[model samples]
Target: MGESGAYRRLPVAERRRQLLVAALDLFSHRPPEQVSIDDIASAAGASRPLVYRYFPGGRQQIYEAALRSAAEQLTACFTEPPAGTPTQRLRNALDRYLAFVADHDAGFSALVRGGCVTETSRTTAIIDEVRRAAAEQVFVHLGVPAPGLMLRMAVRSWIAAVETVSLIWLDEGRQPPADQLRDWLIDHFVAVLTATAAGDPQSSEVLSGFLAAVEGQPRSVR
Candidate 1:
């Protein structure tokens, strides 16, 4: 085959990934409702029939697939190795997450806020899975194999705060800089953990560890 011809025959996985990337790009810039298969095909340098061939369920299938792909990536943002203090580790994780929000502003907003016509039960579940996965990671970072009620609630609350603040940051045109947002979020997490610690022994232990880890690092981090 000629060099040009070689470029036309991607493996099945590569072709699907290419299409999903294109679709995600579109979804990130515009609402999912505004995106079309033709637009995805054009963006991917593939034909409409080709898109259908891979995704027989059509646009809805492609949208769901793209969302699943995005969810996987988002979930990974919180699963970093537990190498640093809880605050430092969370800062690193939040950096990745906020970067994702900034990169996929429109799509992130739509996914979190819902109300998209193409949304389905499966899509909603997938999005929820990301939140659960994130909260689990936070617990893992705290070294809590089995978190108590208050500790669990505190972690989940922080996760929800991160999502809410991310959406608001996007709406506000990403103001105050991403670092500032990340720091503020870390503070919020500390506050939530501290509040929970007062009433829960498990949370008190975790909070002590977190405080010791950040001790003498910097006032801002404290």
Candidate 2:
């Protein structure tokens, strides 16, 4: 079959997915503002008009979609089965999270840095939700049904550190290896919670629980 005929035979949903994957791949390499509709079309093996047909709002619309997809994947990084100790679960989660950073270097950097040229209210909310969801996941790992003020602040502070370190890791050429970074971040969490536990009884209890659980697990990844 001819090239255009082959494209025409693709299901609508499948074509849109192809465009999204292509767009995300481009976005993963460069800042979103640097990518163009023509670039996306060529990457997806589709024409500019065909790209527009699926995304009438053009690059901005596709960017938002790609951002949404990235957000979903990023948020999922912290979720794991409740089968391991707190630190063990966190180790698994950080492995996945850092892997995403390694894969989507530019995209992760752009999202963390903020003020993307295509920034819109919707995109901002999506990005914010990623942070919120990540924090919630940490709380879940702590087995906290309702976190107190100090506990919330402590977790959020560590969450912010994770983003900063990830950006720095990219800026520094991903030095120290991902497992090292992941272990360091988990250690920082333990330390932060420990400090918070000094003043906050809730953090005290959760940290105690986490420490007791950590005793039975492998110290770190092999």
Candidate 3:
């Protein structure tokens, strides 16, 4: 048997998954423009044509798919089981997010900064959706079913801060450890919410509930 005959065949779904995994791996380390169809094909142990068969739009399509996958994972980072204080819960979510940023430093940078040659309206929308979803999850954690304008703005601003700091963390070679960064971000969120609570009745209520949760926790936990 020849070398090609030594390989086993993968089902269509499995083949597609493999190709996506390879593409995502490349995208995680380098910008989309630097990656090629042959790179993905070679990384997946397949031919270039097979990649084309899976993604007809070529590199752009593959980049989009990878971006979508990354966005899903990033959004999921904010999804913690409703069990901790608001601060603890946000910390948990930030833990997951920071881990992802550390794992996919290059791709996270590209996704947040957004000047890639392959970027499109669709990709921009996907990024925006991730931010919206994160802010919404944060609101849910704060026990606010319907947040007011100030409350909503505070949450969105915290999300933006997380993105900006994550990018800076990557640039700084992830110094001061992920835990320090996570704690700093949580403190930032608390500061923002506390300041907003001073003038907005809606925000004040939410802040009270959040603080109650934090206060109920053991000192060690805090």
Give per-model CA RMSD. 3.7, 3.4, 3.2
Of 1 and 2, the candidate ahead on TM-score is 2
Per-residue lDDT of candidate 1, residues 1-222 (tens digit): 122454467888998898999999999888889999999988987788888888999889999999999998888888787676677788899999999899999989988899998888999999889998998888877777788889889998888888998888999989879999999999999999999999998899888878877884432111
Q: Give residue 43's lDDT in candidate 3 (0 to 100).
A: 92
Count backbone clashes in candidate 3: 0
**In candidate 1, which residue pairs get closer than 3 Å at backbone N, Cα or C atoms, i.e. clash?**
none
| TM match of model 1 to true structure | 0.93
Tens-digit per-residue lDDT, 49-115, candidate 2:
8999899999999999999998998898888987767787899999999999999999889877989
User: Which model, 1 or 3, shows the larger lDDT?
Assistant: 1
Off-target runs (Cα >4 Å) in candidate 3 are 1-8, 217-222
TM-scores of all models?
A: 0.93, 0.94, 0.93
Clashing pairs in 2: none
lDDT string, candidate 3, 21-65, tens digits: 899999999977889998998898878777888899999999999
lDDT of 2 at 94: 92
Model 2 spans > 4 angstroms off: 1-3, 217-222
Q: Of the pair 2 and 3, which is ahead by lDDT?
A: 2
